[model samples]
Target: MRHRLFEEGKATDCEEKIASLGRTPQEITQSLLNAEESLLNSLYECMRKDFELANGGGVSLPGYGTKGALALMAIYVAYKNGVGPFPKDLLDKLNEGRDSQHLRHIRREKGIRIAKHGRNEYHLEDLRLGKAFSNRHKGVEAATFAEIKAAYGYRCATCGAKEGELHHLPQYRESKEPVILHQGHMNPHEPLEAGNIIPQCQFCNRAYRNWVVFDRNGRVVGVSDWTFVLKSIRERYLRITEENRKIVQELISSLTTQLGQLGEGE
Candidate 1:
C-alpha cells in the first residue's frame, strides 16, 4: 500500500509547486485529489491495524473479509471529497452493496442527534459520519468487552449485574437472520456510533439472545424485533438519573443561554 504512493506523491508534488506560483482550477483539483488520496491511505492503514487486532491475525491484502476496512476507506474518500460529514444520501452511495449498509441506513433513519467536531467544521444532526467516526473506539478489536463494561458503568442493562462480558447487543454474526436481536443501536461495523451499543450481562445477553428486545420503558417487544426496542431504549435512556439530573438540567440551561447571547452565529 505504501508503494502505491510513489507516483501519486510525485504528481501531487508537481501540482503543489504549480499552486504555489498561482492558483488555477486544474491545480486546485489536483491538490484536492492529492489530499483525498493521502487521507484514504492514512485511513486504510488505521483500518488494517484495527482489523488485524480485532481478528487476532494479520489480515491478507485484497480480501473480502475486510469489509470494515473498505467501509472506512469509503468514508475517508467521502470526507476528502467534501461530501461529509456524510448524511444518508452520501452514505448510501458509499455503501451500495456492503452488508454494513443496512446498519448505516438504519442509523441514518432512526438514530438520535449529536454534535460532531471535524478538522475544520462541526455538525449537529441525526445522520452524520463525523460523529460516527468520532465516537469510534480506537484499535482493531470491535468495542472490546472491557470498554463496554466501562461505558455502562460496569453494570448490565438487563437485570443490572455489575459482573459480565460486554455483549454486542444485536449479535454481529446473526445480523442476516430475519429475526435479529436488537440489543442496542450500535452497529458491529461502526463501533463508534455511541447510541447503538450498550452493556448487557452474560445471562441477559445469552438468555434473551434474540428473545428479549425491549423499548425505552423496559417493555418487551417481540423477540428478534429491534425497531420498537430501539425507540423505547432511546427514550428511556435519554433521561438523567435523579442524582445527576439537576446538574444536567443546569448545564442545558447555561448552554442555551450562552448560545442565545452569540448574536448572528446561527
Candidate 2:
C-alpha cells in the first residue's frame, strides 16, 4: 500500500533551492509559505513540473510518494488562493493517482481520520482554514498571548511582520507535554512561558511543526539564539521585498512606455 502526506520541508526539489541559498529546511518552508505572488508562482510551477516528470506524467506506483504529493499540494494551494484557476489537467492526473490500487489499499487499511462534516472526502480549501474555534483545544492563556504580543512590540519578532499570531517557540503539538514543562531540557515542550513564546506571522508559524533547537555541538537545546534567528529572518524578508520591488518597477516602466507610444500614435 502507498500513502503520501505533504509534510513541511519535504516539498519536491525544495531542498536544492534551499541548499543553493544556504538556508535550513525550516527557513525554506517558511519562505515558501510567506512568499509574494511572483515568487510563489515560480515555486509552484517548478514543483508542478518536477512532480509530473518524476511521476512519469502521473503513473501511479506502489511507492512512498511524499515529494510528488507535496508538489501537487503546493501547486493546488497557489491556484486556490486567488492566484489563478485550478489546473484541471494536473488535478485530473492527481485524481487518477488517488484512485490507484495502492492508494485504495492504504485508505482501506489505515485509519485515516475524517472530520464528521467532511464525510471522508477531503477538500483542498480546508488546508488554510482554521479549526473551528469551538473545537480548538485550550491554548496559551489570553493573558500570556497579550503579554507576548506587547513584549514583541506587536510585530513578528523574526520578520517584523506587523500582523502576526503569538506562537509557542518550540510549538505545542510536538508531544503531550503539559503547556508548562520543565526548563533546561532537550527540546523541552515549554508552551506559555514568556521566553518560549514569540510573535510569528501565520504563514511562518504554520510552515513547520515538531521543531527542535540544536546547538553547534549537535546537541538538542532550548531556544537561546534569538538575536541570530531574528536577524536572519529580517534580512530574508528585506531581500524578498526588494526583489519584488524591482519587478514591480520594471512592470510599471514597461506599461508607461507602452502607453506613451500609444498616445504618440494617436
Candidate 3:
C-alpha cells in the first residue's frame, strides 16, 4: 500500500525516508506542524513590516495591514494547532485583540462609524470615504466609472475582462449620498489611506460579502470572483489619471517595504 501510494505520487520520498528513520506518523505530523508554524510566523512578521512602512512607520494591529492577511493567519494558526471548524468566539477574540482602539476613535471623530456586529466584529461605514476625501481635497475630481475603466484599459484586474464593471474598494455603503464609486482607499472616516481600491468584475465584487479573499499561498489577492456582480459599475466610469497612478505607486511601495522589513526581522 505504501509503495502504491508513493507510485501514485500521493506520498513523498521524504515520508518514506522518515519512516525508515523510525519516526512514527504522529512524529512526522508534529514536525510538519512545527515547520508550518515557523513559516506562518515569518509571513506575519513580513506583513507587519509592510504595514508599518505603508502607514509612515508603525501601525497598530487591526488598524494596519490588509484584513485578509490577519484573517488568513488566524485560520492557518487554528488549523496548525488542530483547531477545527473555526468558532465564532475565537475569531472575535482574535479580531478584538488585534484591532487598534486609537484608530477606531479617530474614525468616529471623523464621522465614520465603526459598526460592531459582535465582540470582535466591526465594519466601517463610508468605506471609501478616505480616498474620496483625499482626491477631492487634492483637487482631483470625483472620477466616474468610465474614467476608472479607461485607466486600466477597461480590463478587469482578476479575469482581464474588458466588458466588466468598475468596483469600489472598501465599497461605498448604500446610505451615502450620491454613492461615490470607483478606486479609492477604504474608510475615509479613518486614517491610513489610499490604494485600497481596484477594478474588479461583478462576479468578484459580489463574492466579497464582507470577507476578503486570499490566494492559495496565503497572500491576499483581493475580493473573490465567484459571483460576477461588479459589472454594473463598468458602464459609467472613466479612466484613471496620472494622479491616481501616483497614489497606487505609493501604496504598493509602502506595503512592499513593510513586508520586506518584517521578513528580515523574522
Candidate 4:
C-alpha cells in the first residue's frame, strides 16, 4: 500500500541531524531507531495488539491500515524525536475538526484524583468524596495540600516554580535504630501522609524520575541535582581510597612476612 510517511515540518531536528551526517538511508534509519528506542517500543506496543489479532485471522494491518493511525504515529515519532507537538500552523490549516478545548480538558485531568470511598464505590454525594485520606493513592486531602502550601508559601518546594502536584516523598518505614530521619524509602503503595508529601511542579517531578540522592554516608539526602551528583562523585572517590588503603596494608604485611622468613633461613 502506497502511503505518504512524513509531512512538511514534521521531521524532527534529531532526525535531520542524523540525516545530515552524510550516512546512507539504511544507516540513518538505524540511527533513528537506536536513538529513539523507547518511542519505537511504545509504538510497537500498539502494533502488538494488531499483530495478535492478525494471528487470530482478524483484519490484516488493522491499526496501520487507517489514516488516523498513520497520523498519530507520525506525530508521536516527531514529538519523541525532539520535534515539538504538531505545528500550530499546520494544525490550523488542516482544520482536522479536533476540539482544542476538549484536548485541554484532557490535559487538565492528566493526574487529577477522582474521589473513591470504598472498593469499587465512587459516590458523588459521599462525604468522603474529594477528601484526601492518609491511605489514598492518587491525591491528598485539601487540608493536607493546604498544609503543604502553608509550609512552602504555595510554591514548589524543589525550585519554587509553581504550585503543582502532590508528590509523595519516601514513606516512613521503621528503621532498626528507631531513629526517624528526613529521607526514607519511597514506597509507591504507601498512604499519602503530610510528612511524606511535598508540593512539586510537573517539570521538577518528571525530570529525573526515581532519582535518589545519597549523602557521604550513603544515605538518600535529596533529589538528583548538582549537589547530589557532586556528593555521589565524592562518595565514589572515598570508597576507592578506602579500598586502596586496605590493598596497601595487605601488600606491606606480605612483604614483612617474606623478609622475616629470609632472616630465619639466613
List model 1 lDDT by residue over 1-266, tens digit each: 12222235555542333223223323322333344545445545643454355446664332322443343343333323233343433323334533244333222332313234443222223212222222232222335656655655666554554453333444632443222122442233333433445555544555555444443223343445455456566889645689778988997899688878886476
TM-score of structure candidate 2: 0.19
Candidates 1 and 2 compared: the better one by TM-score is: 1
Off by over 4 Å in 4: 1-142, 164-190, 213-239, 242-266
Candidate 4's displacement at residue 9, Å, is 84
lDDT of each: 0.41, 0.39, 0.39, 0.37
Q: Which ten residues in a row have the lowest lDDT in candidate 2?
A: 178-187
> TM-scores, in order shown?
0.25, 0.19, 0.20, 0.22
Q: Name the candidate, 2 or 4, with the larger lDDT value.
A: 2
Off by over 4 Å in 3: 1-142, 164-194, 213-266
List the candidate numbers ranked by TM-score, top first.
Answer: 1, 4, 3, 2
In terms of TM-score, the best-performing candidate is 1
Cα lDDT tens digits for candidate 4, 1-266: 11122233476433444233223323323333344545444454443343344344332221433333333333333333334334332322222434222212211232112223333221111111122223222222346556655555665545444333333332211221221112221322244454455555454445434565322122345554445456776888434476388876886799799999999999
Q: lDDT winner between 2 and 3, please give it.
A: 3
**Clash count for each candidate, listed in order shown:** 8, 0, 29, 1
State the local distance difference test value for candidate 4. 0.37
Best candidate according to lDDT: 1
Which candidate do you rate higher for TM-score, 2 or 3?
3
The residue-by-residue lDDT of candidate 2 on 169-245, one tens digit each, is 44533443323211111122544354445545554444323354532122334444445445666887434476388
